[model samples]
Target: MNIAVSIAIPDDEEKQTELSFDELSDRAKEKARDNYRQNYPDDGWWDSSYEDFDKIADMMGICIATKQVPLMNGKNKSVPAIYFSGFWCQGDGACFEGNWYPEKDPLASLTKVMGHAPNDADLHEIAFGLAHLSERCNQLIPEARVKVEHNSRYYHSNSVSYDIDLPMPIHIQEGNELQHMVFDGLRTKLDLDDEAFETEVSDLLRRFMDWMYGLLEEEHEHLTSDEVIDQYLEEMKFDEDGEAIY
Candidate 1:
């Protein structure tokens, strides 16, 4: 004969209900995101990354414009005209209003910062593009001024306009057949007339902006990854039902 016994478990009013492990993990993630936003609002977390970008821009011979800002010490500070928007949604990217000149050795500078191989195809292409454009400017329109301006409400490459003001093209005297022929030959060799030069400049700026967007995206992903978020949540306290405790 077997006896069955039923025992009543006493209710503990002080005890709190614990969430499932998965639920707790999700809550931790939410808390981590909230903490990130509070700590680094308005994408302030990208400051260091932007500094790196500034270095790259300098390497590429991009002279970003600066403005004076009043400081606490009654002095003014200069800030570059770099602008950027972020990781998700359409028309979100990086751009700037600045002047671009050909660097003596942009490939070398890129290699130094990016660790790209010297013979890298894309590297060569970018260097060549800059050099070619500079050459065209020098030969055809010495007094040309190229300004990159961010135009649209968005920050993507399409929103950036490359305005090339060819104030003076090389002028030859009438009936200077020889000089005209030489100029024509140079233009043909470079394959860059005024229109072509504009197109090329637009393409190059867009490429650089794309690269910048990639860098920003990478930085954002690293900052928001699960591992990073977990580290942020390590010191925070949480209550039993997956709610964070103040």
Candidate 2:
């Protein structure tokens, strides 16, 4: 499901065959400006209240939404699921939350729903999909970026249990830095005596790109509702070896 749609800018078809991500971002910015003018056509549009950067950030954030496509042929059958979604700006700082879903629910991970240990391939696919989504949104709205995949690990004992915040693949943009400090703080939670495993940023991006290239070589299947799959899983029973026993 790591698919991307090409966004076109007006009057550029002759010169450029395909629009770049940066081009789309510029187009989005223009669209936002046009939206402002359309909403307020009179002189009151230039009121001092509009000068507030925080308000402007919120307005810009509100302007963009994930493109939705129909799942089935009938009307009102379309459902949009965001693999990764977040919005932020200079005055407002940054707040991006991203999650990869095995199916329609963003909160449900493959390991959780499938009740199996995650393999390298599964983790790679999830991270790659989220990375592509992050790139897609980042190009459109530079400030709308997700740098970290947030999750938690639980440690349990007979009497008590504790939860620790963990970090997944995190990407850093070289240039056009925005809200770096705030995002850095939010990326990973650390304690003075706490220990953690850190994944190399380069390795994560490389895996993501590798996954992207593989998608180009394969044919994608049109997926239907996951209700049938869910039912099957519900009926399934597993053994100690994690194999389906029934």
Candidate 3:
């Protein structure tokens, strides 16, 4: 009796023991990008960049209210109450509720960062409007107080509202005819009627909110860009199939 046996062996060149190094690297990089996106699909990645905005607001004489949060060391830290949405979508934007005071030269402070020579007419107008409002408020309405608040469910610039309280001057309260005449004349010269005053304040605040949104958008774009993601992925590791390793 005799028996016959047959065996088939796979070609060595056709078998892949592991992905090529370059291919694995490329896949890993892509996987990293996916992971980054998953972790931060929207505005979740802007915390680190928000400090710059807070500083800018302060320089512009805007005092943002702060909330106290407990730290790991059992101490409380104050964080600015800055609110924002996104770079896209109709209702997605930024706004803040805070107190604004007159700075020595707010336009200079703004230009130092937002550019000295702005080509955008709206930006130029907003800058000058805010400056002029600040000057007039400081000189005429010394006792006037303003509070900015967000009134809409959406985050667009128009959602912000201003509450400006202009107290009558002491001389006007005393009811002197001469003082009344003088006050009326000054108010007229400064174009400070109630309607005009409110309009100017509202315009300045809404425009400033728009500018804040622009800054947030620029920072968001930079953080989510491929180059930035690659920098973040430098320490990441991946397995042969491009799956991320712990």
**Each prediction's whole-model lDDT (CA):** 0.66, 0.30, 0.69
Tens-digit lDDT track of model 2 for 1-246? 899999877784454233322233444434433433333334332223222312222222211122345435654432211122111222211111222211222223233422332454644354444444334333322232213332322111111112323322256455525655544444433211113212332233334323322332221111112332333334444333323334
- Kindly report which residue stretches of model 1 are placed more than 4 angstroms away from their true locations once superposed: 1-42, 67-77, 104-125, 135-144, 167-181
Query: Model 3's lDDT to the true fold?
Result: 0.69
User: TM-scores, in order shown?
Assistant: 0.71, 0.19, 0.72
Tens digit per residue, CA lDDT, model 1, 46-161: 66766666665676566777656576799986666667787678768887778876555545655554453355455446546666566555656555567898888888778877
True-vs-predicted CA distance for residue 92, candidate 2, Å: 33
What is the TM-score of candidate 3? 0.72
**Model 3 worst lDDT window (10 residues):** 15-24
RMSD each, Å: 7.2, 28.1, 5.4
- In model 1, the worst 10-residue window by lDDT is 14-23
Which segments of candidate 2 are over 4 A away from where they belong? 1-66, 70-76, 79-216, 220-246
Q: By the lDDT metric, which is better: model 1 or model 2?
A: 1
